[model samples]
Target: MTTMTDTSPREFKMPDVGEGLTEAEILKWYVQPGDTVTDGQVVCEVETAKAAVELPIPYDGVVRALHFPEGTTVDVGTSIIAVDVASGAAPAPASEAASASASAEKAAPATPAAPAAKPAPAAKKIEGRKPVLVGYGVAESSTKRRPRKGVPATAAPAEDTLYAAAAIQAVQGELNGHGHAPGGQRPLAKPPVRKLAKDLGVDLATITPSGPDGVITREDVHAAVAPPKAPEPVVEAPSAPAAPAVAPAPVASYDGARETRIPVKGVRKATAAAMVGSAFTAPHVTEFVTVDVTRTMKLVEELKQDRELAGLRVNPLLLIAKALLVAIKRHPDINASWDEAAQEIVVKHYVNLGIAAATPRGLIVPNIKDAHAKTLPQLAESLGELVSTAKEGRTSPAAMQGGTVTITNVGVFGIDTGTPILNPGESAILAVGSIKLQPWVHKGKVKARQVTTLALSFDHRLVDGELGSKVLADVAAILEQPKRLITWA
Candidate 1:
C-alpha cells in the first residue's frame, strides 16, 4: 500500500458580503466547533446593514473553532470561524497512474510554458465527493417539502364527483364560502346580493330569487332587506287626554381611587437614566437650518435603479451619513466629547458616528466606528447594518459606547423638525427632518421643491455657536447639492 500526504488546512475569513459593511454582529450559530459542515449550508445568522441575514458556510470540513461569542461584534476580514479539512486528501498524489491519467485528460489546456497539473490518486477516492471552497463544486439537489402536520391521509375523490361538488358548492356557498350559513345551504342569491342580504341581516330563506339562472340579484336582496314604511298618525290622538309626567331614575357613581402602575424595566429604565444624566451634565444648545434637498432626492432615486446595488437597501439616511462624515472632517471639534471624571476634553481624530435609531425596544444609538475612514459604498452598508442591528435589539455594549457625534433621522416618522436631546456622553446630535414638496422661488420662477429641516443640538461647553453653525451648514450644503459631496471627498 502507498502512503498519502495530507493537504494543508486553510483559514476562511469573513468576506465583505455587502458593499462596505466593515463589521457584523453574530446573531446565532448553526454549527459548533466539532460538527461537520457542508459548503453552502447555512452556518450562522448575522445582522447586516439592511437586514438580519443567514450566512452560508463557504467551506466543507469539520468546524475547528468559533472566534467570537454569539453577541460579539467582529470586523470584516476577521477570522470568525475556522474549518479543518481531513488529512490524506490532497488534490493530487504520485500513485494510481490510471486515475491521474484520466484527470489530466479531462483538465483544461494551459499556456505553452506551464504544464497541466495532475489529479488525485485512485486510493484517495472516497464513496462521497466533498465540495471545494472556491470555484466550481458539486451541486446539491434542492430541498423537498416535508409533509404538513395535522393533515390526515385520505383516498382521492372521483373526477365526476369533484366537478359536480365544485359546481354545486359554488351555487350553495353563494359563490364564496364566507356567505354560507352554519349548515351548507344555498341562500337564494348570488355573491353580491348575498353580501347586501348579510349587511341588512335579511333571512335569505324567506326571500325568492327573481333573476336568470334562479339567482337573486342586488335588487332582490334590497327589496327583501328593506324595512316597511311607517303609516301616517291618526287624528283621533287629539281627542285623548294628556298623560302624566314621570321622574327620572337616579344615576350611579363610581370611585376614582384606583390607579394603574407599570414597572420601568429594560429599555424604558435605561433610557430614563440616560436622558436625565445627559440633560443635567451636558449644557444643551440647539440650532436649526432649513434646506432644499431636491438634488439629494434625485440621487437617491438613481442609486435605487443601479444594478450594482441590487440587494442593498439604499435610502436617504445613507446620504445623511455621508454628509455627516464630510462635515466631521471639516469640523472635527464637533466630533469630540467632554470627559468630566478625567477633567479633560477628549478630542478624537477618528469619528465613531452614532445613528440614533428608534427601535421596538426604545431609543438606541449604535454607532459605526471610524466612520470617516469608510468610503461611500461602505458607509451605506454600515448604515444598513447599524439600523438592522438596532431594530433587532442585538446591538452590543461596545457599539453603543464611544460615540462622538450622532445623526437622528426624524424624517422617517414624518416629523418636520425637533430639538433632539444629546446622547449621554456625546457632544452633539443632528436631527434630519422630513422631506416635503413646498412652493419656493427657483431661478426667478415659482416652483415646487423638496425641503427639509436640520436641527443640531450640542453641549454648549464644547461646541460654541460658530462651530456648531458651521458643522450644521456643512451637512445641509452637502444635502442641498449632492454633487458637493464628491468635490468635498
Candidate 2:
C-alpha cells in the first residue's frame, strides 16, 4: 500500500488479477480523468493470458489519470491509475497529469542505486501501519526510522537512509506478494518467475533482484541462467581488402492493401504455446474408429422428449461424453496423467471433463468438475453452462484448470475427423467427427446408418497401443448399441 497525503494522488497499481499472471493488456477503461469513482467500483477491464478480468478501485476518489491507454500491456505492481483521495476535489486535467508524471520521472536519479529514494519518504510514513486489505492499508502508527544495515544511524548518507526506509516498506508489502523478502527470508518472486527459475535450474536466492523492493523478477531469473559471454577479441584488419559482405536475402514483402496481420496475444498466445508444448512433450498416438451412431442419435431424440431430461441439451456429444466416462470407469487407467517430474503415471479417481469451445477471443477448454459423478441431466446442464460462459468470455481461470480428459466436437464444423493434440497435462482427448448418413453393415445386410468417426489421442508414454485401442473400442461399442450405456455403465 502507498501512503497518501491530503493532496497527493493515491496511485493504484495493476494487480495480479489471475494468480501468477505477470501482466495484462488494458481492454477498456470504465472511468476517465476527473471522473468520480466509489470504493469497490470497477475502473478498468484487463485481458490477462488466462481471461478478461475487471479491476476495482480500493479507495473512493476522482480519477486523476490513467497511466496507460487501452491496448497497452502493463506489468503487475506497476501503477496504472492515480486517484485524488481528498474529499470533493476534482482531478487535474489529463495534460497536467501527464506533464506532472513526466516531470517526476525526469527528476529521479539516473543511477539505479537510489531510484527508490524518490518514493521512500511517502512510503516510510506508513511503515508501521497494519494492512487493511490485500494491497491497501491504513495509517495507524508513526514509527521512528530504522537504521540501514552496515550503516550507523547517525553516519549513513541521507539518500542511503531514505533508500533503506523505502526498501523496508516494500519488503513488508512483499509478504503479500508485491515486493522482496528481507534478509534470511525466502526470495521474493512472482509464481511465474519461480516456475521459470525451476525450469532453467536456477536458484532464486543466487540471483540479485533488480525489481522494486528487492523482488526477483523474470529477467533476474533468466539472467542467472544465461551464461556469461567472453570479451570479444579485437583483430587488426588485414592489409588485403575485406571480402564483400553477402547481401542479405531480400526481405519478404507483402502488399499492404491486400494483406492483414493480427498480433497474437492474450488467450490466443497462451493457447498456441500450450499446444506446441503438449505436442512435443507428449508422444501422441491417435487411434481412429468409425462407428454407426444411428442408435445413439435415436436415443438423444428420445431423451429430449423425456420429462427428466426436459430443458437439457440432449445431444450426441452428451452421450459420447457419458460413454467415455463409463469406459474410464471400466478401464480406470485411461483417465490418468503422465507425471514426468515424478517419473510415474498418476491415475485419477475423479474426472474433470473438459469441453473445447471456440469463442470470439480464441479456443478455451473449460471443464466440469467431478463430471464422472454427475447424472446425465446434470452433465448436460454443466455442459450448457460451460458453453454459454465461454461464448460470453466469462470463463474463469479455475474453470480451465485440472482437466483430466477433453472432448472436442469437430462434428459441428462439418469435419469428418481430426487428430486433436492432447490438452497439456491431460492424458487423452477425444475428437468427435461429423455424424452423417452412410452405408454400413447392419444385421446381415448393408443399410444406410448414421455414422461418425471418433479419434482418441493419448500420450504414448503412459497409454500403450493396447490401452488406447480398448478405450476407443468401448466408446464405439456404446455408440453403436446405445443400450450398452445402461448395461455397461
Candidate 3:
C-alpha cells in the first residue's frame, strides 16, 4: 500500500478577490488561533475598496495563527491566517461531498492529481482531522467583547503604550484648554466627537450638553453652528482701514528631513500602472456633444415603478448602456480595438461592455460579458451585479479583461464632462455627465429642458473621427427620444 504524508500546516494567503485590489482591512475575525476550521468556511470579514467581503478558509485545519490583527490592513497575496490540517480526516460531510461532486462535474479536463493513499497510522490521524460538524466549520465561540484599545485581559506592553499615547494627547489638550476639564469634569463623550468638534472649528467647552449624562450630542454641535438668517438691510458707516493683510501663515510643512514613507501596496500602485499604460499606448481623440435627455429621464421614472424592474436598480446609466449598445451596432468600428503588436485591428463580434467604476481604491472597469446579447431587463440585472460586485471588491480577474467598449459615469461624482482615458485594450470610452435643467431653443421657442453632455474618447488609430462622431450622435439621438432605441436596435 502507498504511504501518505500529512499535509498539515497550510497557510491561507489573502487572495486577489477583485480587479487589482491590493490591500484589505480586517473587519472581523470569524476564527481565532487554535480554533478548528473546515474547508470553504468563512474565516474572516475584510473590507476592500468595493465592500466588506467574507473570506473562506480553504483547508480543514486548526488555525495556527492570525497573521494580522482584526482592523489591521494587509496586502493581497499575504498570508493572513495559517492552519494545521488534520492528518486522516474522513471524507467531508454529505453537504461538502455533494458540493465536491458538483465541482468535479463542472471542472474541465486535467484536474489536479488526488492526494496519495496513506498507511493505517496516517489514516487514523487523518480520521481525527475529520470535522466534528457539517458545512464550512463550527461558528466561532462567542466571548465577551474586548475593548479595542487600553488594557486587555492578557497583559501586554503594546496595550500600555497605546494607553499612554491616549493619555498624553488628553493631558496636552487639557493644558491648552482645548479638551474637556479633568474628571467629574463634565459629560462623558468619546474622543471622536471631540475630534469632530475641533474639525468644525467649534469650541466644545462653550456648548451646553443635552444628553442624559450631559454629553454633547452631534445635533447640539449642528445647532450651535447653524448659519444666521438674512438680516434686515442696515445703513452702515464706512469701516476703518483694514489692517495690512499678513500673507496667510504658510501651512505647516511635513518633517521632510526626517522622511516618512507610505508603502505603495494597494490601489495607488494599481492605478499608476493602469493610467500610464492607457495614456502612452492608446492614440486617443475626444469628442463632445450636448443633448436634451428629458425623455430618457422620464422613461427612467416610468421604469422605476414597473414591476419587472422592481428590486433591481433602475437609473440613467441603464438607459445610457442600452443606447451605447444600440449605437455600437450601428457603428461597429467604434467598438473595435487596435492590436499594435499584431499589426491589426480587432473588431469584436460581441460587446463585453465595461462600466468604469470609481472605487475607494481606484478606478476599475469590470465588464459584463456578452452584454449585447442581454435584453434590457437582463442587462439591468447584469449592470447591477457588476457594480455591486465591483463596489464589494469581488470583481474577478475574468470580469476585468476583454472589454470592447467602456462607459465612465462621471455624472455620479458631479463632474460635467471629461475626456476619459481609454481603458487599455478597449477602443472607446464614453463619458456621461450630470443632467441639469438648462434653457434650450427648440422649434423657435426657448424652454427649460433636461440637458447632459456626452464625451466620447476613442483610439484614433482604430476609429476615424467620422465613425466616432456617428457613435456619439446615435447615442444622443436615442437619449433625446427613448423610443428611438427600440427602432434602432
Tell me, by lDDT, which candidate is best. Answer: 2
- Write the residue-wise lDDT of candidate 2 on 230-259 in tens digits: 322222335434333334466556633567
Q: Candidate 1 at 122: error in angstroms? A: 38
The residue ranges of model 1 lying beyond 4 angstroms of the native Cα positions read: 1-259
Clashing residue pairs, backbone N/CA/C < 3 A, model 2: 174-179
For candidate 3, the C-alpha RMSD (Å) to the true structure equals 15.5
Task: Evaluate all candidate structures by whole-model CA lDDT and list the values in order.
Answer: 0.64, 0.73, 0.67
TM-score of 2: 0.65
Off by over 4 Å in 3: 1-263, 392-394
True-vs-predicted CA distance for residue 201, candidate 3, Å: 26
Which pairs of residues collide in candidate 1? 20-378, 48-385, 49-384, 49-385
Q: What is the lDDT of residue 131 in candidate 1?
A: 25
Candidate 2 runs further than 4 Å off = 1-6, 87-256
Q: Give the worst 10-residue stretch by lDDT in candidate 1.
A: 150-159
Per-residue CA lDDT of candidate 3, range 1-489, in tens? 243444546666776554566887775676778987755445775655433445655446788888999768898878888887675442232333334434543563244233122133333433443222112222231111232332222211221232233222222121111233345133334333443555477766677768554666667777668876432222122452333233456665673355757655344656577778999988789999999999899999999999998888899999999999999999887778777779999888999999988654567788999999998889999999989766544454567778889999999888899989988888899999999999998779999999999999998888888999999999999999999988999
TM-score of each: 0.49, 0.65, 0.58
